[model samples]
Target chain A: MARWGMVIDLDKCTACGACMAACREENNIPASGPELAGDGRSIFWMDMLTITEGEYPNIKKRMLPRPCFQCENPPCTKVCPVGATYKNEDGLVAQIYARCIGCRYCVNGCPYNAKYFNWYPPRFRDEEKRYLNPDVSVRPKGVVEKCSFCAHRLVRVREKAAAENREIADGDFTTACQDTCPAKAIAFGDLDNPYSEVSRLAHSVRAFTLLEDLGTRPKVFYLTEGEKHGRFKI
Target chain B: MDDSKYNELDEELLLRPILKTGKWFYISCAILFSIAMFAVWVWYHQWSTGLGVTGMNRPVFWGIYITNFVFFIGISHAGTLISAILRLCQAEWRRAITRAAEVITVLVLFFGVFNIIVDLGRPDRALNVLKHGQFRSPLLWDVTSISIYLTASSTYLLLPLIPDIALLRERKTRLRWLYRLLSFGWTGTDKQKHRLEKAISVMAILVIPIAISVHTVVSWVFGMTVQPMWHSTIFGPYFVVGAIYSGMAALLVAMALIRKLYHLERYIKEIHFNNLGKLLLVFTLLWFYFTFTEYLTTFYGSEPTHMTVFYSKLTGHFAPEFWVMVLCCFLIPLAVLVRKKTRTAAGCVVASIAITIGMWLERFTIVVPTLVNPRLPYPRGIYHPTWVEWSITAGCFAFFILLYMAFTKIFPIVSIWEIKEGRESSVSETADRVKTYLPT
Candidate 1:
């Protein structure tokens, strides 16, 4: 009955892409190199956006790590033709690979650009294959894949918690990105728990959600640095 | 009752003598069917290899498959709406065009539904739509509405044709067995006439809303999304207007083609083209208005997510296609249709093709541009169709043409019974009305 959420502190973040790489590896995402990137072939689950403010010399650049917001009222799930993608009870958007008709309506419906389609069959080098997360199933060609909030890991964490005869603790579950942040600016916990770190941090004046006008009611919150005006560009 | 009047009636009733067996007809059909089979082969390849074969990618996931679906469905709307509207208005000229238009609607509906399956990654599992469909999804709405529209349209298209079939059955003694089966025991009695009138009336009334719902549901597939370009309230009426616009153009094209092929220039005169062109012009303006209103609101708001997609369509990667759609769909067609000399059958033919192609490009522009411009921007997504996608798309067109051609051969493409009824019912009724209205 716990609702998972994340608060990313923009102040400590220095735009390092280590979180991106770690998340990709942890999720078993296939890397799409140069040839396919602009041609609609690239597949990146968590994409980082750079938004710059002010004129040159006084320019301030901000890096925003973007993943699926996992909206409570997800537009992506509403348009899927075959029930391939759906929002679970815990508010995590999930894809049912076997049922997908690959109509790509969900991909088109998602405003976040969070979803990635497998253009060609996934190409993994020998080392990359060895590094693949055994817990997550590798996606085949045509079907879409995106950030599942490390759903597979959550399952393992839940099983462990159950074995201990207790519910999941505040720190028991975390996304690959939240666990890998070098700056420790990211916090993940149950939003349903008032005592949880995510719930406490989400109420900060520095905390705000993206595209609030869209009415998506995203579970992910971003806490700005609050040091400079217009510091967070996008 | 007089001999002279009866002979005049007979001549009017038989516009053109029905041509029964022909070797060339059979040969052409076989060739077309074979081509359709080849297209099916390409579709099978797509089924196995996945969408990777097509030019479509993540952002451009729709491409030709969705475009063709919209195109074919738009074309199908022509017959039902035109016939119903004209019949309700009591337009006498509708008689000649109704049967031909109805046939187009039925054939194109079949093609439209087939194209969706062709676009599916797992078309074999299409049955799951009924088995496990979610009511909240717009896609499920589309499935339900399209089926309902198709059923209502087919019935509407065929009900008027039955009397025509019966007429053909009465004349063709050699093929009595075949006619007897298709005639559905129509006796052409006063009671039968009353029953047929009632059926046509009910179908005509029901078909209009169903037709509107079909396109509205299709738009919901895009509008229900939170994607910047697609998430507009205007999408419902906007899509319906586009459907009718393209549908009208398609009807005009079919009329021209049928007139030429069947040498029915006398029946399908310049007036029909002129009237249809005028209707097309109205739609062209309406389409422009909708596009302007939809874009102006998005532009004025200047929402970054909306602007990214708007700019992408207006001056970015999709600029060429976007402008081309505007030109072909509205500007050029309008120019050609406005002038009397260019509003001829040939001119209308060119315009119809333009409108059809333009509408398809519109779908592509709408689907792909928004996808490339994500809410949280990454590197812009790119889409290139693989050969399999191209092959499958081509095959779908071939399949449609094949179905239409086959349909023409199996039944009289020009509904025999309807034409006879038209010929039988038209002149006398007009003369009676004229007689009643004349001052003594």
Candidate 2:
């Protein structure tokens, strides 16, 4: 079984927010409108974590595009009483939207704060509904939704690969955020495959996972923003 | 105030509210019932409109509902644990007060469990917890323990009540049918009384552990999580202490109210409060120790994640609530309950009211500040409970009082047989028991 993972190179990222927009469209995440957004009810499958450093005019800012880390030892899934969120065989942490009791236990359990609860039913104008990705389900209000590593794309690609009598290859499935990165910052592939880009990127000296000491063992890695040093610089 | 009334201290005063309905009782019932109805409507509004009616959002996934859940559950501990302990110790003074305390446990538990359901984003699908039960989750542990506690506590509340219900059956009241049905054919034969007393004694022994487990499990709901300040070793015992502290205060307030409303001064005397007040003093000290240890450990350890939440409560946005909680749960209660001059039944009630409010704030502080200050650099979440939360909270308190009032209307709030039994035999039993324990 393949463990789907991601690596985002901070040095290459421009933080233009294309990934956020593309993710909303790909995942059918509803536009929560300004009022709800201001109330902290806004849902973002691929959100930007803006890191501001230094002070005054000398300030440095870097936006890190964040998706669910899909931890090997996911604390979120462990606390879900209903087993609504779980790590599937392919090693992607996925949600069973229908089964979610919306206790929000997993939301509180996750150290990274990756999960988002739907505060309202997904709403769109009659014309806007057509723009929603047919492959994605519109999550109901009260249930949590998060990054699925574009699992639907994986399913479609798997079917295609089977029909062609071949293995599901690298680059066959890519997350919306990874596909939309103009600077080629985000990498998505089978982390177990040593030949895959994500696998090599993840082994880089600058590679780090958010809150590694938490023991969540996140599959998502980040290449540090500044100068690349030490071993495996490329 | 009558000399004749003092001459005869019997079940007549205890049964007065049941037999003769007071005007204020009906008035309070109507008011409480209307508020409860309004709260139901508000909850429905939240249900139909989604949980968004409350001020809860992304980071602050829980708010007043969780606070109320913990608060009510903590209050519930006041009843069963105290009554059980008193019964186990054979405290003669517990006779008039145990029923009042037990009723609080049985009644408060419903609200405590219901707050969790109401807080659910999908209350309709709550059965998912049972269907696809994950034992690993602390929430499931809570579900299991609390249900066991509810069953055990309700049984505990009812077991001692059999003799009282049987006595109520003797009176030719309108609801004599319920009394008869509930009394379980207790003809008060020596054999029946012996069995009933044995059953109550066994349950009294059993309930203390169950009661402790319930609060500890409740604490684990937060403590098990990896949240900064929450993931602490002291939480289980700390929460149990707080539960008992709050429970003690709640029981005092309840007893004081019943004493005034039901003209139960002859039974629920100042001395009962005095004994409970002494216990309350010990708990007040214990609560302070736990609070100090918890915060100090967090403060001194200086774990950045823990510090953020600690500072938030200590001097940030939650400073007012934190200090007030300290005042109510610690300082005021300590000041009022410590002195011999001020530690009256009236003083106990005043301190209890403060402790109840303080404990609720304590729950709020424990739940919110951690979520608001997450480990990540996410913007800090500020919680402001909306009208929906406030209304439901007020309604629950009002309804709890209303239930207590209703409890008095149907049955004697004071156990008839136990106190009568106390009157007949406690003196001799104590003398005999004392001699057994006395060294030659």
Q: Pick the candidate with the highest lDDT.
A: 2
Q: What tens digits encode model 1's per-residue C-alpha lDDT throughout B1-440?
A: 54213344442333343444357656866776776777778777776776666777666567767777877787777889888888877677786787777777887887788878877766777787887788888889989999898889888877876776676676644556776787789988999989998999888888899888988888888888777878789998998899888888878887897687656775678998988888888888999999999999999999877888899999998899999999999888999998989998989988999998899888888877776666663556676656665666666666666666555544555554545555667678878888998998
Candidate 1 chain A has its poorest 10 consecutive residues by lDDT at A225-234
Task: Write one digit per residue (lDDT tens) for candidate 2, span B64-86.
Answer: 99999999999999999999999
For candidate 2 chain B, the 10 contiguous residues with the lowest summed lDDT are: B1-10
In order, the B-chain TM-scores come to: 0.90, 0.97
Cα-lDDT of candidate 2: 0.89
Q: Please tell me what DockQ candidate 1 reaches.
A: 0.55
Please identify model 1 stretches exceeding 4 Å from their true place.
A32-38, A52-61, A121-134, A227-234, B1-35, B168-179, B384-387, B431-440
Native contacts recovered by model 1: 0.62
True contacts kept of each: 0.62, 0.78
Tell me the lDDT of model 2 at B72. 93
Q: Over the stretch A38-95, how does candidate 1's per-residue lDDT look in tens digits?
A: 5667766767777777899998777877778888878788877667799887779999
